[model samples]
Target: MPTSPSDTLQRFYTAFSQLDHATMAECYAPEAEFDDEAFSLRGRDQVAGMWRMLCSATRKSGAAHWKLEFRDLHADGLQGRAHWEAHYTFSATGRRVHNIIDAEFTFNEAGLILRHRDRFSFWRWSRQALGLPGLLLGWSPSLKRQVRSTAANNLRKFLALPPA
Candidate 1:
């Protein structure tokens, strides 16, 4: 049986909390597009790759733990939204980061996520993730561009690595 949008979201969150990238990827359609403040991805491969990179980054950090919390999920027709947060320590800074995100999703007829966009305050995130530099320049557009560039570079590097 096909999953409903809410069911798909629940599965996505469950998979994510368990660092199950494969299951998380299955929540999306092949042509899915996902965008956040730092990374923008098109297609399932890129989106799934992002999750792999992030989940692995967290695991490798050792000093940080990742937690996922979500509530108020609602779906009607082909759209859905969720309020979620990722609580972890920023790898580089080792500072605690509580990223509050509002996710908007569009589902295909089969209820696969076709598009997922996450909105959050970059300045707020930067302050927690980058510390002093983030506090000083997190609000700058240039900072946002730099962060995006770094994210894209990280994604490329991750994609280039041989599968384990």
Candidate 2:
């Protein structure tokens, strides 16, 4: 039987909480799209790779530095929404960050996520992740674009790597 949209979202976030990128990947349709403050991506491989990279970093930071909570889930038809929070050490700056995000999702007929978007405050995130520079330029469009570019490059490099 096909999964419900709510169940798919729940499984995705639950897998994320456990740092299980493989399970997270399973939640996406093969042509899925994802967007967030730092990155915008198309295709499940890219989206899943982003999750894998993040989960790997969180795992390396140790369990003490990583936490995830999700709630307020709602689904109607093929659409769903949820609120979540993530606490993790930013790998780039070794700074602690607590990010609150609201996510919207559209599901395919098979109940996999076809499109997922996460909204969060870039200014708040930058202040925590980038320290002084973030405090000064977090609200700037250029800074946001730069962050997206850097993240895309990082993901590209990661995708080029041979699988473990």
Candidate 3:
């Protein structure tokens, strides 16, 4: 029997709050896809790796605190959205960045996530959270294009890697 989408979503959020990578990985279907502003990753392994990287970076930067306020849950437990905040110090600049973001999720049968997306404005985000560098560099069309392209390439590479 399949778990309800709401149940799956709750489990995912709990796992994320706990930073339980194994549990987080289990919440995704084998071929689940995730698209954030930074990259698009497909498959459980790739998504898991992305989470691992994010967790590591978060820990390293002392920004592991994640507070998720679920705004809505629907789609017969298959879809939902939430508002979240992440508080952390930037590893590169040691700047404390508090980011407010919106996240949405869709789950497949077997209680796994099929699609996950995060919404945020890169230009506004870069300028506000990232400071002068973000303000100056983020607005450059060339830089933005490069960032997107590089993220896509990285996701492809991650997907190509052998599963752990």
Which candidate leads the pack in lDDT?
2
TM-score of each: 0.96, 0.97, 0.77
Per-model RMSD to reference: 1.3, 0.9, 3.4
lDDT of 3 by residue, 1-164 (tens): 67777777677767776667777888789989988767677888788887766665566666444444444544555776666666666554566666666878887767668898988777766665568878888777776677668656765665576654
lDDT of 2 by residue, 1-164 (tens): 58999999989999999999999999999999999998889999999999999898788875588999999988899999999999999998899999999999999998899999999999999999999999999999999999999999999998899876
Clashing pairs in 2: none
- Which scores greater on lDDT, model 2 or model 3? 2
Sorted on lDDT, highest at the top, how do the candidates line up? 2, 1, 3
Least accurate 10 contiguous residues by lDDT in model 2: 56-65
Best by TM-score: 2
Q: Relative to the true structure, how large is the alpha-carbon lDDT of every model? A: 0.90, 0.93, 0.70
Error of 1 at 27 (Å): 0.4
Locate the minimum summed-lDDT window of 10 residues in model 1. 57-66
Clashes of 3: 3
